[model samples]
Target chain A: MNLDLRIPMGLLFTLVGLILTLYGAGTNGSPIYASSLGINANLYWGLVLLVFGGSMYILGRRGQRRMEREPQKPADTDSGAARRGH
Target chain B: MIHTELTYVDWIIMLLYFVFVLGIGFALKRFMKTSKDFFQAGRALPAWICGLAFISANLGAQEVIGMGASGAKYGLETAHFYGIGAIPAMIFVGIFMMPFYYGSKARSVPEFLRLRFDEKTRALNACSFAVMTVFSSGISMYAMARLIQALHVFDHLFLVMGWPLGWIFTFSIVLSAIIVLLYIFLGGLTSAIYNEVLQFFLIIAGFLPLVLIGLKSVGGWQGMKTAVASIDPRMLHEWKGIMHPATNPMGIDIIGLAMGLGFVLGSGYWCTDFLVIQTAMASHNMDAARKVPLIAALPKMIFPFLVILPGLLAISIATPHTTTTVSMQGGAIIHETNIVPPEVEQGRGLVPAKVNPVTGKPMLDASGKPLLDYDMATPNMLLHFFPTGILGLGLTALLASFMSGMAGNVTAFNTVFTYDLYQSYIHKNASDKHYLAVGRWATVGGILLSICTAYAAINFNNIMDTLQLVFSFVNAPLFATFLLGMFWKRTTGDGAFIGLISGTLAAVLHHGLSLPLEAHPGIHGGWIHVLHTYPSDMAQNFYTAIWAFSANLIITILVSLMGKPKPEAELVGLVHSLTPKPDTGHATWWRRPEALAVLLVVLLVVLNIFFF
Candidate 1:
C-alpha cells in the first residue's frame, strides 16, 4: 500500500490552486470577462481547485499522522520486485 | 482572424507551468526503482488520477483543434463522435472488459491476448500497436510544430534574434521532443500520468475562459445559435442529412456512426488500445481500474461544448457567406451560393485576409462577408477573447495537451517494444534491471523514430484523418478479435492470429478499392475508384473499419469452430463466465462498475437528446 502520492499531489494542486484563486479574485470585476458571457469562470474554477486541493492535503496529512502513530513498521510493498506475466 | 498581445505576466505564468511539470518529472525519477514503476507507475495510481490521464491522453492539441475544425465543417453533427462513438464503448470497457484486464493481471493489452489465446496473437497486436503508436506520436509532434508556425509564435522571436524563419518548425519540434524525452526518460509512465493530470487542469483553466469570452462576444449560447443558424441551418442539426449518405456533406448516416465508429473503432480504442488502457492498468486495484474509463466518460461526453463550439463560433465570426452567382456551360445559373470569389481568394484568405484601403479593416464583399478559414477557428477565437496573461495560459494549455498526448504514446511505444518484442524474442529471461535499461533507451529511440514518423505523416492531408486511417487499418478488426476471445472459450490461437492479419488486409483492400476518382475536399483516405464513392473522408474511414471488422468477426468464428475448444478449467480469469468477482462484495451500488456504467449511459442519452 504505497499510498505516498497524496502529499506531493496535494502540494502541487494547492500551490496552483492558490495562485489561480487570487488571480480570479483580483480579476473578478474586470471588463476582460465581458467577452466571456459575463461569467467569472476563473473565480469559480479556481475556488473549486482550491477546495479539491485542500481536501486532498488534509486527507494526506491525516494519513501521514495515522501512519506515524503506528510503530515504525517496514513497508510491505513489492516495489522493486519484478512482476510475473499473466 | 484575431490578434492578442502577450505581457510579462503571461510569459512568467507559462514559464512557471513548464518548470513545475519538468520539476515533477525529475523528482519522480528517484522512485523508478523498478521497470514496473517506469512502465506501470508501480501499479499504484488512484482511480481519479488514472481517470483524468486516461481521457487526457486522447485529448491532445490535435484533437482540440480538429474538433473545432469538425464543428466549423459539420456543425452539431460532430457531437456523434462523443455521443455515439465514445460513451457506449467506454461503459462496455469499464464494466465488462476491465474484469479480465485487471483480474488476469496482464501487464499490457498484448499480454491479455497472449493469456487468452497465444503468443502469435500477442505478437501481431504488439507489432502493429508499436508501429501505430510511433506514427501517431510523430503526427502530434508535426501537428504541434505546424500549429505554432501557423500562429507565428516564433516569427517575432526569430526576427529579434536574427534567425531564419525556415528553422522555426524544425526548432520547435526538436526542442519539445528533447524536453519530453528527458522527463519520460527520468520518470517514465509515472511522469506522463502526473503531467497528464496537470495538463487536464491546465486545459480547463485555459479553455474555460476562452469559451466564456467567446460566448459573451457572440452574446451567449443563444447568440451563437442565431449566428450559426443564420450562416447555415444544417450546422444546427445533429442528424439532418444523415439519412442520405451520398448526398450529405458528412458522408455516413447514423447507422454508419453506430456500427462503424461506435461498435468497431470505438470499442477497439477504448477497450484494447494500450495507449489508452495503460493509465487504467496503473490503478491500485480492480475496482479502481474499472472506475478509470468510466470516470473518463463524463468529460468525453461534454468536451464538444468547448472543443467543437469554438470552431462553429469562429466560422460565424469569419462569415464567408457572400452570395455569388455562377453560370454553367449549359447556361444554367446558380444563384446566391455562399462561396469565396476567385479574385478575393487570389488576393486574400491564404495566410491573412486583404485589408480595405480606407478603413484598414479586413476587406468585406458586397454582401458584407470576409474570407473564412474554418480550421483556424479555435486559435482565432483564443486570440479574439484572451488578453495578455490569459493568452499565454491558453496557448500553454494547448501545448500541454500536445505534450501529454506525445508522452502517453512514447510510454506505450517503449513498453510494447521492450516487453512484447525485445524481451520475449531477442533477450529472453533478462533481469528486471536489464529490462529497465532497455525501456530507457527505447524512450530515446522512440522519440527519434517519432520525429521521422512526424515528417512522414505530413504527406497526408489532416492529422485527424491520418489517425482515423490508422484506426481503420489496425484497431477496428482487432476489436472483433478481442470481443470473441474474451467471452468465448472456443476461440483458438490460430483463429485469433490469422483473423487479425486478414482483417488488416481487408481494411487496406477496402480503402484502396472504394474511394472516388476526383480529389475531394475533406477527403484524406487512401481510397481509389473501384467499388463505392463516399461523399466525405468520415464515411470512407467508417466504412473501411466496418468492412474490416465484419471480415474479422466472420473469419475468427469460422477458424475457432474448426479446432477443439479449450476446457473451462484452463480459462478461469480469462473467460467472462468463469471469472467471478469475489472482491466486489464490499462495493456499494455507486462504486460498482456496472452501476457506474448505467449511470454514465443514462447521462449520455440525456446529452444526446438535449443536443438532438
Candidate 2:
C-alpha cells in the first residue's frame, strides 16, 4: 500500500489515545482534574481521539486493500499539461 | 496566580512525543529517494492534509505568541487580522490566482514571477523571500526559547547545573533549532507536513482545554467581558474607536484596516508570499490546490478564538494594571510602552506590580488589581489550567507549534534556494541527483542562517513589530506587481522590475521620513534613519504598506502603458484575459473552490457586520 497519511496519522493517534486513556482511567477522580474544573479531559478526549483514529485506520486499510487489488498506473506526466513531480 | 507545575509524568509524555516526532522523520527518510518527495511531498498530498499543513506552516510562534500578545494588548482588534486582513486576501488567492500557481507548472512562487514578469523580478522576490524565511524562522526559534525561559520549562536542570539564565536561553534555542534541522534533513517537506498535521492536533488538544478552564475560572465570556469592561470598555468590541486611529489600540480604523491591512498587507501576504502557498502547491491536483487555502480558511476563521481568547481571558486574571503602561482613551487601555521591561527579558509587557511591604507579596492597586505581563497571557494560561502530565503535553504542543513554523520556513527556503536561485543562476544543467544534494546543503545553510537570525531576535523588543517591518520592506509592494502582471497582459518585464524596486524604496522612505509619533512602539535597530515615529508601530506599518502599494500600482501601470507588451500568444495561460479557464471538473459544492470562496466571503461579511 502507498504511504497514505490516514494510516500513519491513525496509528499515531491511536497510540497516544490509548496511553492517555489508560493513564486517565487509572487516575480518575484525582485532584488534578480540579484545575481543569473537575473535567477528566484526558479520558474524555482520549476516547474521542481513539474513535476518530480507529475509523481513519479502517478507512485507510480499505483504501490500501483496494489499491493492492487494482492495476498500478504511471503518474500523468503528459507534456503541456501541469502534472505531479514538477 | 498559576505556577509552573511540571512533574515526572509530564517529562515522560514529552520524551515519548519526541520519540514519535523523530521516529516519523527517520521512518519517512526512504521517501527522500527523489527531490520530489523531499521538497514537494511528491505533489500527491490530499487537500485536507495540505490545507491543515498550510495553516500549520504559519501556526508558528507568531500566530500563537504574537496573536495572543496582540489579543491581550489590542483586545478584539486582533480578530481584524483574521477577518479583514486574512480572509479576503485568501479568497482572492483561491478563486483568482491559484491557476497561475498550479496550472502554469511553476515549482515555486519566485519561478512564477519569472514566468509572468522578468528575470530581475523573480530574483528580487527570491532573494527577499529567502532572507525573510530565515529571519522568520529565527523569530519563531527565539519566541520558543523565550517562552521556555519565561515558563521556566528547564529551570530544574538549569538550577542543578548552576547555569546562567542567558546560557540556558541560548541552549533552548539551539536545542529547538537542532531538532527542526534533524527532521527537515531526514524526511524533508513530507516530514514537516506530517509533523505540522500532528502539531495542529496537539495544539488543539493542548490549548482548547486551557481556554475552557480559563473561561470557567473567569466566570464565563459574559463575566469576563464585564470584568474587562471595568478595565476598558473598548476591549469588548472589534470596531471600537476604529474611527480615530490615535485613540484606538490598533491605532488605525477603517482606512488602515481596509486599505493598509486588508488590501496591501493582506493581499501581499496571502497572495504573493510563498511560504503558505508552497503548501497549497503540494496538493494532488490543481483542484486540490485551489481547495487547500479554502479549506484552511475554514479553520483560520475560527483560530482567533483558540489563540486570542486566551489573551482576552488573561486580562480577567492578571489585569494589565502596572508595569505595562497604557493610556486610557474611550475607556480602553492603549499600550504606551512597547519594549520589554528592564527587569524582565521576555519583551513586551511583563511589568512588575507593587508589593505589600508587610507580607512582601504583590500589593493590590486602588481598584484591587493584579499586576500583568500581557505577553505572558498564553503561557500563564497554560501554567494556570493544567496539572503535571497534561501541562507537559500542553508545553510540548506549544513547542511543536513553534517548531512547525520554523520547519515551514526552512523547507520553503531550501526549495527556493534550490529551484529559483541555484538552478536558474548557479548551476544550469545539473542532474536531479545533484540538485537534490544541493537542496540538502541549502537546508543546512538555511538552519545556520536562522540560528544567526534567532540571536538577532534578542535585540528586537517584539516579534510582531519585527514581522511587520519585514512585511513593510518586502511583501507590501509585491501584490501590486503580481496583480498588474497577472491580469494586465500589457505589463512588461522592465516595467514590472522598475515598479517593484521603486515601490520597495517608497516603503523604506515613508517609514524613514515620517515624523516619529510618541505612540510608536518599536525602536528602529538596523534601519534607524527614522525622521520621526508614528503614533504606533501598527500605524506606521499600515501607512507604509499603503504608500508602497500605491507607488507600485501607479508606477507599474504607467511603465506598462509606455512599454511594448508581450505577444498574446506568448501570454496565453499566464494572463487572466488571454488565458482560458481550466475545466477542473470539481463541480460538487464543497469541492469547488468558488463555492468555498463564496461561502467564506459571506461568513466574513457576517463577521464584520457583527463586529461592527
Candidate 3:
C-alpha cells in the first residue's frame, strides 16, 4: 500500500506512448495508413498517449514527493494486523 | 472471421502491459504481510483508486463484448443497462448501504449476513458466492480464449512454428490464466485493484479512438443515426415504440425494465455482489467507502459511448469495398476486402449468421431463420478502423479487460474461501500468517479450477449455459434478502435462509413455465411446460427476475413473522435505522457523498432524456 499506484501506471503509459509515437513517426505517410482512411492515426494517437502518459508520470512523482514529506501513521499499518478475525 | 496481421510493435505494447502488471505484483509483495492485506488490501486504498477499481472489476471481456453485441441487437436502448439499471442502484448503495458494510467491520459480505442474521444464512451465501465467482472467472477466460481463437490472433505464429492451428485456444487460455494467477498470487487484492485502475485507463485509451474513427467513418452521430434509421428507425431511439414487448428492440416495456433490471438485477449485482462491493470495502475510511460507488457512477454513466457506440457504428457504417493485396508464403497473391457488407438487413445489420460447423451451412432456428452472431460487432469495428500500430493498442486494451476481470474474481473467490469457509469452519484458530498462506494457496486453487471450467466450457457449451442460468437464478432474488436484512431488524436467519431458497426456486419455476416466442423448450426456458410465451427472451428474463424478487420479499416477511428476531442490541451497526449517520468529514458540499449522488442523479436524468 506504500507504493503510489500512479507511478507504475505512469511508467506503463509512458512506455506504450513512446513505442506508438516512434512507430507512428516512422510509419508516417506509409500506405499502411490507407486502412485508417489516410489518417496518420499512429502519429496523432501516439502524441495523445504521450501527453496522457507524461501527465500521469508527473502527478505520480509529485504524490511520491508529498508522501515523503509527511510520513504515514504507524497505526494505519497496525489496524490490519490487529483486526485479524471477525 | 476477420483476421488482421499484427506488427512487432503491437507485440511490444502487449508484452509491456504484462510486464507492468507483474511488476506491480512484485512491488507490492512486501505490503501483503497479512491475510487482511492479501484479501482486502488492508482497507487502505483512497477513494479514487477504489472508485475506478469498483467499475473495472465488473468490466470484464464479456461486458465489453456482450454490451457491444447488445448495442447492435437492441440499439440505443442498451444504455438502459447503465442509465436506469446501474446508476440508481450505485447511488443507493453509496448513500445508504456503505455505512453498514464499512461500519460493521465485517471482513466479507457473507460475514455481514452472519452478524445480522445467523450461521445458516452466511454459510449458504458464502458457499454459493464462492462457487459463482470461480465459474464466472472461468467463463471470462473461456470467452476471451474463444474470441482470440475466432480472431486468429496467434495463428500465424503457430503456423510458423509448425504447431497445429487448434493450439491457439489452449495456448491463449493457459497463457492468460498464468498471467492472472501470478499477479493476484504475488500482490493479492492490492495488485488486482491497482491493475484494475490501469486497465480502466487503457480501456478508454483503446476504445475512445475506435469510437472516434468509427463515428468519422459513419459521418458522426447525426450520420450514424441517419444510416441506422434507414434500416430501423426504432433502433436509434431509447424509448420509442417501447409500449409493448413486441415494439421495442429489447422486447420489454418500461415496467419490466424498471422493476426487473433497474430494481432487482441492478441492486442485486451492484449492491450485494462481492466482486464490486469488495473494491469499495477496500477503501481507507468509511467516508471514502461511501463515496466509492458515487465516484464510479460518473464513468459508469458515460461508458456507453466508449463501449456500445462501436456496435452502432458497426451496424450503421457502410465500409467501402477496397482490395488489400497480400503475398502468400508460396508466392501466391491474394486480395482481401471488407467482410461486413454496407447494406444490412433489419435486426441483422453487419452481424453474420451462426454456421453449423459440421455442415458448413448457416444454422437455422426453430422458425427456420438463420441465427445471427451479433457478438462480432465490436471486434468487426476494431478491424474495420484500426491500422497495425494502433490496432495493437486496441487489442491490448481488450487483453487488459480480460485479465482485470479474471483477477477480480480470483481475489473475491480466495477471500471468501479463506475467511468465510476455511477460517470459520475448517480451522477456526489458525494464526494470521497461516491463514495468509492458505489465502495464497486458495488463489492458485481458484485459478486452476477456473482453467478446468474453461476447458469444460470449450467441450460442453450447453453445460456452461446451464451453469450461467442457474447462477442467475441464485442471484436474481439476492437484492431482496439484502434489502430486508439491512433495513428491517426483524429479519431472522431462518427467514433469510428459507427466503433465499424459495426465491431461487421461484426463478426456476418461472423460467420452467415460460418460453420465448419462436424458441424451443430447453435452455431458453420452458423446461417444465410452455404455460406462457413471452414476446422475446429478454421479456421472459425480466419477468422471471421480478417474480423471484417479489417471492423473496413476501416470503421473508412471512417467515420472519413466525420466527424470533435477532436481538436489536447486536444489530446496531448492521441495520440501517439503528446505525448512526455516517460523518461526511470536513469535505465541502460538492465533495460530500450526498452532493455527489445528487449530481450523478441529475446527469443520469439528462442522459436518459437525451437518449429518450
Compared with the true structure, all predictions reach lDDT values of 0.76, 0.77, 0.86
Pairwise DockQ winner, candidates 1 and 2: 2
Output the number of the DockQ-best candidate: 3
Ranked by lDDT from best down, the candidates are 3, 2, 1
* Per-residue lDDT of candidate 3, residues A1-86 (tens digit): 68888888988888888888898898787666666777888888988988888899899899888878888543222121122222
- The digit string of per-residue lDDT tens for model 3 on B77-137 reads 8998999789999999999898888778888999988888889899999999999999999
Give the residue spans of candidate 2 off by over 4 A: A67-86, B157-166, B318-372, B459-471, B519-534
Q: In candidate 1, what are the lDDT values of residues B1-612, reduced to their tens digit?
A: 223345444556667777877887778888898998899888877788899899999998878988987888778988988887888888888888887887777789998888888898899889988988888888889889988887776676788799999999899899789878988999899899888888887787778767766776677888888888876777786766778775455767777788988898888888888999999989877778888999999888879887988877775554332433222224342333455544324322222344554775666555666644455768767765664446666888888899889999999999999999999889999899999999999999999998987776666546656665665688779899988987888889888888988899899888877763353423453445456776666777788889899999889899988987678777778887676653555667777777888889789878877777
How big is the positional error of residue B35 in model 2, measured in Å on the Cα after superposition? 2.1
RMSD of 3: 3.4
Docking class of 2: acceptable
* Model 3 per-residue lDDT at B499: 96
- Please estimate how well model 2 matches the true structure, expressed as its whole-model Cα lDDT: 0.77
Native-to-model Cα distance after best TM-score fit, residue B96 in candidate 3, in Å: 0.3
DockQ of each: 0.16, 0.29, 0.36
Q: What's each prediction's TM-score?
A: 0.85, 0.88, 0.95
Best-fitting candidate, scored by lDDT: 3
Task: Give the proportion of true interface contacts each model preserves, from 0 to 1.
Answer: 0.07, 0.19, 0.42
